[model samples]
Target: MELSQEEILARLAAISQGTAVEAMKITITEAFKDRVVATMPIEDQHRQIVGYLHGGVSVLLAETVASVASVLNIDIDRQLAFGLEINANHVRPKKDGVVRAIATPLHLGRTTHVWDIKIVDEQERLICVSRCTVAVVEKPAS
Candidate 1:
C-alpha cells in the first residue's frame, strides 16, 4: 500500500530534524506518487562564502526528495531503497529567498528507480536540476 501524504510529511519532518537536513532547514511540503516537494529557506548557514546558495545544498535537497519518493514506491517489508547515483547542475544563483525542489519519477522499476529533481527560487527561477538513481534491494535478515 502506498503511504499517505501525512505519513510522508511526518517522515520528512523527522528527517529534517536530523543532522544535515536540519542544518539546511529543509521542510517537505508535498509528497505523492507523481511528485515530491520540499523547501529550504535561504540563511547564512545555507550560503557559500560569496553569498550564493551553496550548490551542495541544492544537491542535498534534490537527493533527499528523490530518495524519499523512490523509497515510498517500494514494499518496505521485502525491499529497501538506496541511492546509487546522483548528479546536479546548478543553473542560477540566489543570495536570498526560499528555494523549493520538486521531484518526479523518470522511471520506476522493480529493482531500480530514476528521478528528476528541479530546484527553484521563490520567484520560480530555476536554480538547479538533478537526477538520482536508486537501487531496490532485498531486506537483510534481522
Candidate 2:
C-alpha cells in the first residue's frame, strides 16, 4: 500500500534525528516523488563571521532536500540514496528570518537522480541556487 503524505513526512522526520538536518533545524515542509521543500532559520549557528547566512548551510539544505526527495522516489526497503555531488551559487545575503528551499528533480535515472534546489528568503527572493546529484544503490545487508 502507498503511504500517505503525512506518513512520509513523519518518516522523514524520524530519519532526521541526530543528523545535521535536525541540528540545523531544517524542517521538511513538503515531500513528494517529484519535489521536496524545507525551511531553516538564520540563527547564529547558520551565520558566518560577518553574520550573513553561511554558504555551507545553504548547500546542506539543498542537498538534504534532494536526498530526501530521492528517498521518496525509491524503494527504501531495497534501495539507499546518498548525495554524490552538489554545487551551489549563493546569490543574496540573509541576516535573519527563515529561508525556504524548494527542490525538484531534473533527472531521475536508474542509478542517479539530479535535483535543482532554490533557496529563498521571507520575501521570496533568491538566496541560493543548487544542483545536487544523488546516487541510488541497493541497500546493504545489515
**Model number with the top TM-score:** 2
After superposition, which runs of candidate 2 have C-alpha atoms over 4 Å from their true positions?
none
Quote each prediction's TM-score.
0.91, 0.97
Worst 10-residue lDDT window for candidate 1 reads 11-20
Local distance difference test values of all predictions, in order: 0.88, 0.95
TM-score, predicted candidate 2 vs. hidden true structure = 0.97
Clashes of each: 0, 0
The number of the candidate with the highest lDDT is 2
Give a tens-digit lDDT track for model 2, residues 68-110.
Answer: 9998889889999999999999999999999999999999999
Clashes of 2: 0
Residue 43 CA displacement from its true place in model 2, Å: 0.4
Score residue 112 of candidate 1 by CA lDDT. Answer: 92
Q: What C-alpha lDDT, on a 0 to 100 scale, does residue 141 get in candidate 2?
A: 88
